[model samples]
Target: MVASQLGADGYDHTLGDFTAAAFTARAREEAGWLERLSTLEAATPDDAIDRDLVLSQLRGWVALASWPDWRRDPAVYLSAVFTSLFNPFQQRLKPEPELVAAAVSRLAEVPGVLAACRANLDPDLAAPLLVRRGLDQARTGRRFLTRTVPSMVRDPALSARLAEAAEPAARAFDELVAFLEGFACGGDWRMGERLYSTLLRERELLGYGAAELHEKGGAAWASLDERMREVARRAGGTADWRAVMESLMDDHPPTLEAMRAEYEAETRRVREFVRSRDLVTFPEGEKCLVLPSAEYTRPVAAVAHYLAPPPLTSSRTGVFFVPFTPDDFTEEEVRQRLRTNSRAQMPSIAAHETYPGHHWHLSHMAGNPRTVRKVFRTPYFSEGWALYVEKLLHEQGYFDTPATELAHLDCRVFRAARIVVDTALHCDDMSIEQAETFMATKASLTPGTARAEVSRYCAWPTQAPSYLTGALEIDRIRQAYQGSLKAFHDRIAGAGGLPLGLAERAVSRPGEGTPAG
Candidate 1:
């Protein structure tokens, strides 16, 4: 289903099978691949790195197979349905007729796929938070199928066929939502200390455990807060960072339209900054577009989203999606959103999401000759690189003003707080409400945005920590590297999205003893 949504050839016309047998079969296939990978002899350093990457990915997959998310997470099936039906239209990789046919084929399978979801899930084991999330997505998906999908088709006959298929699909979504509403909701969402630590050690190959993560994150949060206060004194002749942050929000654009235009202009500014500074080489034939988040994606994607260039397709345009206020939002709701995306913060946002951040790093990764590296990526590298560049740009005098510097530091402080909140939620018994309050107070986020961020942390354990932890690790790597700044950036980008440990090995000097797979 993921491949289909990414426009990988031959996968567009089908949906994933979510039945128990399919799960077992997929595990078996992964084990077989692991065995084959173990027998290969890597002839070069790049091949060795790819071998290690694939092995680690397969091991993680095999380990996670024991959890049986298919039996507990309904969003797995619902998201597969939404992505499968929506991507063909959004990507438009094929001719219109072919795209419609593929969508209709996948639409025809939605009822069965959703039925399999019902058969597989254990109502007693459903987490209430996740169930609520699924309900929101299902409602959005139903709207997409019934109200949004038919308008995408051009031909009248194809449009009629799409509507016919959408009727049953939308009905299936409604049924799923109804079932979720009555869920037993007894399961715990936390990964717990043991499983969370295991993912950090085995999957991310980190050196520390959950306790150390919490400790380090707490220290960083304090350090960043103190730094922000100093910067605030410089900016406003006061030592109150909170007041400075609040004041910055009042300087935002009056409307969402002006905000979008600000983002567009900011992206252009950052692109030129990178080029003039000789930061890193841009990939050939690649461009990043600033756009509004799609309607179907807005339920979960509350702030910003980066859609990477499709791996298997020829298109090299990456999209950076900024959230747009809905038509029905009240004035206060609009103000809250604009405050979160204030003009003072636009440069940092542009640097983190587009030029020299996700778009630049991913475009380079997409050009990697090794398929394994492109397929198996870690946020440790992706998000870390983006965050690392923010700091890099700051050091290079990109954000020279006191206000901009405070905004950048506040963002850093937010990532630091994420590490603490993510660890506390999973290991230290922090309640959802407590985590949201912590995020809002420490990160200076609006209440609604704080809730959105915490909700994501619950569903995705360890991911929130990756932003800060990954950036710190990359900074460590840069300290030991012997090259110009641009050379260091290019070297890491050339290694693709390897785990930072493997990336360290990839960028090592001749006598530094690169490890075998």
Candidate 2:
């Protein structure tokens, strides 16, 4: 019963137990068994499995668990934690070594938990243990993978094999632990070349070698720099780009009151603009709010981040987390940052983070009939759609002022530089020192800013490349559609929104015709 839910690929196991709980009580009761059974069922075609229903349940499960607060337990939150850790492109502002260590210890105990689950078999005893074990692995895996190498080393290929082999859960457990231990002991303190390369490949799924990715990133950096200079030249900026950026960062920034007022005003204006323009209908589940950034994230905190609403319930409000950097800058500097985070950009940001970006995408996926599609989100698809929204707004003339346009360009330059820095660091072709220099020189970032950015790239790896890679793919799809359809733009708007995979499939298929409303 459990095996049927996993589908043919068995990649569904990686999604963990949280998502499986949303279907029937039986699913929640035996999520692990269900997942295991699903894998077995996939390998055995004769098994009577309801793939579509299982997929729907999986989607609902993910939708319910997408919220950040879902993984409250250190043991349970392992997967997301490790996923974030291994992919340098997704590092948190502050690294939590202690939390990671605790998770790692828990992961070392997974075999016992699995044994307990197998012994019980009945839901009354088995379900709780299975769920706990899943959470434990997720939490521990996240910490171990991010903080050290043990998690990956213990069982690199076992996960795939386990998905293939039926029964012998004990063997699967042992293999996983062995792989993790070997991975941990294989190298020095710093993640060496092999681990870095493996991580990059695993995260990106791009099939490109590290060296190739580095070269591609370098090309993108050069292209973006030339474009930035051209934009500056047209704006009549006499100073060098760095000097110009420094000049923009004033000594005294706006007060928190002023900043809040500006954000609120912009939010209202943008909300009205999108509606007046007849952009896709904003879902009722969408909600927006403003909050100060936590103390830990202050140094690297951006002007704001949009917290997408939860999937289980319609909490329409999206959170806009703004860091209160009171002591960091003066009133003038604050005002400059606030101005950059302007009303004109609000609609664009909203479009990216809420309306047609994360919020809209997740909402639609959550509501979709296919559960697998909803639970299994690829960063390439998610981030790519958000980045595409930025370009979409620009094409529609959203940047009405010089300052607004500059801000938009600034963001583009930042993302382009991220691709270069991420690829360069992991490939070992460019040292941390060299990456920092390139960021400061080419991206017009300050030394402090460059250092933080480089650290993030080094820590997380293939994530940075997703912004440009995803956006470019989306752009190609849109162009292909426009070539065939007279009203391509209207068709997209009218169709509500297309599923990420469906869009990719349609674009990739040779004779699928063009995208339609």
Candidate 1 to truth, TM: 0.94
C-alpha lDDT of all candidate models, in order: 0.82, 0.46
Native RMSD of candidate 1 (Å) = 3.0
lDDT of 1 at 432: 94
lDDT of 2 by residue, 1-517 (tens): 1221222232212323333233234335444544654554443211122232243234434333322122212222333323322322121111334323433433444444434323323332212322333432432332233323333223435333322222232344444444323321111112335544553443333455556656766776677666656655544464254445444444222566565555555556555655566554555455555555433234444445555443333344455555455345666555555544444345555556654566555544444333333334445657777777677667666667554555566666667777767766665567778988987776545565566567556444466777776676677778766344324332332222233334444343332222232
Off by over 4 Å in 1: 35-41, 153-160, 325-329, 509-517
Worst 10 residues of 1 by lDDT: 508-517
Clashes of each: 0, 51
Give the Å error, residue 397, model 2.
0.7
